[model samples]
Target chain A: MVFLSFINNLINGVSLGSVYAIIALGYTMVYGIAKMLNFAHGDIIMVGAYVCFFMVSSFGLNPVFGILSAILVCTVLGILIEQLAYKPLRQANSLAVLITAIGVSYFLQNAAQLMWTSNPRIFPAIFGNGGLQLAGGQLMVPYKTLVTIGVCVIIMVGLILFTGKTRTGKAMRACSEDKEAAQLMGINVNRTISITFAIGSALAAVAGVLLCASYPKLIPTTGSMPGIKAFTAAVFGGIGSIPGAFLGGILLGVIEIFSSAYLSTELANAIVFLVLIVVLLVKPTGLLGKRTSEKV
Target chain B: MLKVEGINVYYDKIHAIKDVSFQVKEGEIVALIGANGAGKTTTLHTVTGLIRPKSGAITYFPEREANLYDLTKMPPHKMVEMGLAHVPEGRRIFLQMTVLENLEMGAFCKGKATKEDLDRVFARFPRLQERKKQVAGTLSGGEQQMLAMGRALMSHPKLLMLDEPSMGLSPILVEQIFDIIVELHRSGTTILLVEQNAEMALQIADRAYVLESGRVVMEGVGSELAASEEIRKAYLGG
Candidate 1:
């Protein structure tokens, strides 16, 4: 019975980790290309969740359409934010850009509160309460858990291939290394950055939907804690690396789940943060980050 | 053919280029030799549209005729499209990418690099071909310089501008790089060479200009400047 419970917790941890992985992918990619920490990225998740919620519940659309619309809306919002908020400040210092990003984050959170109100809405279970029974009903894996894990895996593989093979992907990698050189090569730096924001925000939509589905709590602040945790996850794995974000997210989720289960429910977050601090102290660059040295 | 009619440029408050005027005619090797901080790189940058000039005009005649375009108004990438390739200072090839990838990026303006283009560059630098799969950062300094030149050649540029191509290389490697520059010039590419090594630059250049404190102090035929007593004292070492 103990073993079965452990297996259940492991699955739960992975499911939560999968959502964090998606969110971290958004953070890492934006940070890598734009060289800015976009604090407003979390609020994008809130907006996406609201869009998906209204589409399915109020508009009575199919769940697939709701998800698609959410992605589209978030993608457009991401591009707009980058152009209006980030582009003008491209030549500004890092501190200024960081402050602007924080301001944008607060604007999004307050806008969401005004639109959706503070009361938490129970998100509709689009996947329904279903599961696979194994070991003669001794263990069951929920469909939501299975789907979340599967989607995360697919997105990871797709991202790897896209970045590895495509022209635009190579251009993005080049821009990340040296924007001025990339521009000199006729790579259109601004367009590449806009495309990055679009991709990151689209992933944010998927993360938002999955997060609400698993937790079933739809609120303006629903994305905040998860967002911070995923950002931590990105740092844990190596902020600019895609694979790092995945590893960090999974480890963070597992740690959080295990700590809450075995230690204390109230201290799960604190434990997770403590583990992060220890890891950073040892590695400095996170698990998979490259140690970059300046060339003379 | 290119013409710069007294262009002035500033980097913030510092005047980097003061009424700098020089021209590269068809099939000519033009060298701009100057000491460090004398604005040789800035002159090349202004011509390539990487930096906007405070005043004056830069005109490019693709056909060497009445058709001329104002380079100051054009974007840097558009300058590449007009068959102008700049091998920037410090050999700024993408270090994380492989040699092949760096060359491919050089041909970015051309949509895709043809097999012929690859062969052409490979023929020029067989060393790059051998190490095409190697990450650029792992290559030796000399190899990186060769790769930078090979990358610029991939654009099939009409006019190739090289900035400090010999920086940080051994004397033997510098000779090899200069030899490659002369060879590239022989194959119908107008060249704009910027160097602090005045002796070697003057030897290969058809016409050369000397810059001091952002001003063109002297201009004459390569051999005459090389033979001049003042030139020998100021640039060629007394």
Candidate 2:
């Protein structure tokens, strides 16, 4: 019975971790190519979730269509935010850009609150009750968990292939390395950066739906916790690395779930942060980060 | 063919380049030799559309008698598309990318390079071909320099501007680099070479301009200036 419970918790931890991984992919990609912290990135999840909710509840659309609409909306929103707010400040000091990002984040949260109100809404169970049972019904995993994990895996694989094989992806990597050099090479750096934001926000849309589906509750501020955690995951896995984000998210999720299960439930959040601190103390660049030295 | 006429550039309150004018006829090697901060780099940057000069007009002639296009308003990418390539100082090859990827970036102006072009670049710099899969940053200085030049050539530029190609190279490597420059020039590419190594610059150049304190101090045939006593003392290091 104890062994069975451990497996159950493990499954739950993986599901939770996969969601964080999805969210962190957005954070890392934006940070990597754009070189901005993008506090507004987290709020994209909130915007996506709200969009999905409205489409399904008010318009009686299929959940799949609602999810697609959310992706498109968030993608456009991300590009608009970058073009309007970030592009003008590209040459400005880092501090100014950071503060602007924070401002954008708050603006998104407040806008959502104004539109949807502060009341929490329950997410409809799109997948019917009960999930696949394994080992003669000894272990029960929710269908949402399975779906979230499955989606996360597909996205992760697709992203790796996209970045590794595509021409635009190469241009993105070139831009991040040296914007001037990329420009000299005939790349439209501004266009590349805009595309990067679009991809990140689209990923965030998927994450938002899956995250709310698992929790089954939505509020204007519902994305705050997941957003922050995913950012943390990006840092833990090395800020700019794609695979690192994936690894960090899964690790953080598992650690958080296991801590909550076997240790003090009240200290789960504290434990997650504590692990981050320790890891950072040991490896200043994070696990997969390359040490870069400036040349004269 | 390219022409710069009375171009003045300022970095905020400081005038970095003043009334600089020069011209490069087709199939010629023109060297702009100067001390550091004397505006050789600034002049090159202006020509490549990386910097907009406050005064004077810069023009490009793709064919000897073709329409001359004003280049002052073009962006760097557009300048590259118009068949100009600048290999900036410091061997600014993408450090994290593989050598092949770096070369691929050079072809970005054309949208893509044919396999024959890639093979030609590889044939010119076999060292790069051998280490094509290796990360560019890990390569030695000479290898990195080769990658930078090979990348610039991938665009099949009609005119190539090289800024201080010998800046940090050793004596032996410097010889090899100059040989490559001569080879490239011989292959029908117009060259605008900028260098602080005035001796080497004059040896390979057909015509040269001497820039001092943001102004053109001397202009003559490369060998005439090289033999001049005053030029020898000021730049050729006796």
Candidate 3:
């Protein structure tokens, strides 16, 4: 019975980690290209979840359509936010941009509260409830958990290929390295940044759906914990590195779940942060982060 | 062909370029020789649209085409698309990317470059082809310079502007860079080279301009300037 429960907890941990990984991808990509820490990135996931909820519950649409709608809405929203809020401030001081990002986060939360009301809304399962039985009834994992893991794996692989092979991907890497040089190479730096935001938001939509499906609750504030945790994962993995975000998210998720399962549940959040502090103390650049020598 | 009228540029409160003017005619190698902070880079940046001039009319006349462009109004990417390439100072090659990837980015405005195009660049710098898979940051200074030029060539620009292509290079590497520049010019590419090595630049250039601080101090035939006692004492370090 202990072994079965451990296995179940491990599955739960992986599912949660995958969601964080998805959200972390957005944060890392945006930070890598634009060189700005977007604090409001987490709220994008909340907006996506809310969009999905409305599509399913109010419009009586199929769950897949709801997911698609969420992605579309979130992508447009991300691009709009970048153009309207961030573009004007591109050449401004980093501190000013950071404060604006925090302001945007607050705006998103308040807007969601005003539009959807402060009450927590129950989320319907995309896939009907219950576990997929493996090795008969002794080992059962929720279909949602399996689906989440599978989706995460696919997205991660796709992202790897996209960054490595495509022309625009090369442009993105170039832009991240040096914006002026990338422009000299004939890349439209502003357009590239917009694309980065659009893709990041689309990934956030996937994370939002998976998160709401597992937790079964949605509120304006639903994004805060996951968003902060995902940002932590991004930092722990090496803030600008994509694979680092993946590894960090999974490890964080596993640690958080196992701690809650075996140790005191109250200490799980604290322990996760403790581990991060320890890792940072040892490696200031985080795992997989390349140490950059300051150019004079 | 490229032309620049009176242009002023400033960085914050500090005036950088003061009423700078020059022109690069078709099929000519024009050298802009200046000392450190003499505004050679500022001039190139202005032409590339990396830095917009405060007041100037910079015109680009495309060969075999009736249309002319006011480059001052355009952005860097558009300037590149209009067949102007600037190989910046310090190489500025994407350090984390592979050599081949760096070259691919050169052709970004062109949409797609054929295998023949790749081979043409490879033929010019065989070392780049050998180390195509190697990370660019690991390459030596000479290799990095070659990669920077090769990558710029990938765009097939009609006018190639190089900013201090010989900076920090060994004598042999500098000679090699000059040789490649001459070869590129021989093959019908209009060259606008900004160099601190006035001796070599004037030796190879068709026409030359001497800039002091931010102003154009001298303009004439390259060899005539190279023979001048004032030019020799100030720039050529005789």
Best by lDDT: 3
Give the C-alpha miss distance for residue A2 in model 2, angstroms: 1.8
Instruction: Tally clashes: model 1.
Output: 0
For B119-149, candidate 1 gives per-residue lDDT tens digits of: 9999999999999999898888899999989
Separate DockQ for every predicted complex:
0.67, 0.69, 0.64
lDDT of 3 by residue, B144-168 (tens): 9999999999988899999999999
Over the full model, what C-alpha lDDT does candidate 2 score relative to the true structure? 0.90
Q: Report the TM-score of candidate 2, chain A only.
A: 0.97
How big is the positional error of residue A142 in model 1, measured in Å on the Cα after superposition? 1.2
Instruction: Score every model by TM-score.
Output: 0.98, 0.97, 0.98
Pairs that collide, model 1: none
Regions of candidate 2 where Cα sits further than 4 Å from its true position:
A293-296
Q: Lowest-lDDT window of 10 residues in candidate 1 chain A?
A: A287-296
> Against the correct fold, how does model 1 do in TM-score?
0.98
Classify candidate 2 by CAPRI docking class.
medium
Candidate 3 structure quality by residue, lDDT tens digits, A1-296: 89888888998899999999999888999999999988888999999999999999989999999999999999999999999999999899999999999999999999999999989999998877898897678988889998999988888888878888999888999999999999999999999999999999999998999999999889998988899999999999999899988888988999999999899799999999999999999999889787764221
Query: Taking chain A by itself, what TM-score does each prediction score?
Result: 0.98, 0.97, 0.97
Q: Which model, 1 or 3, shows the larger TM-score? A: 3
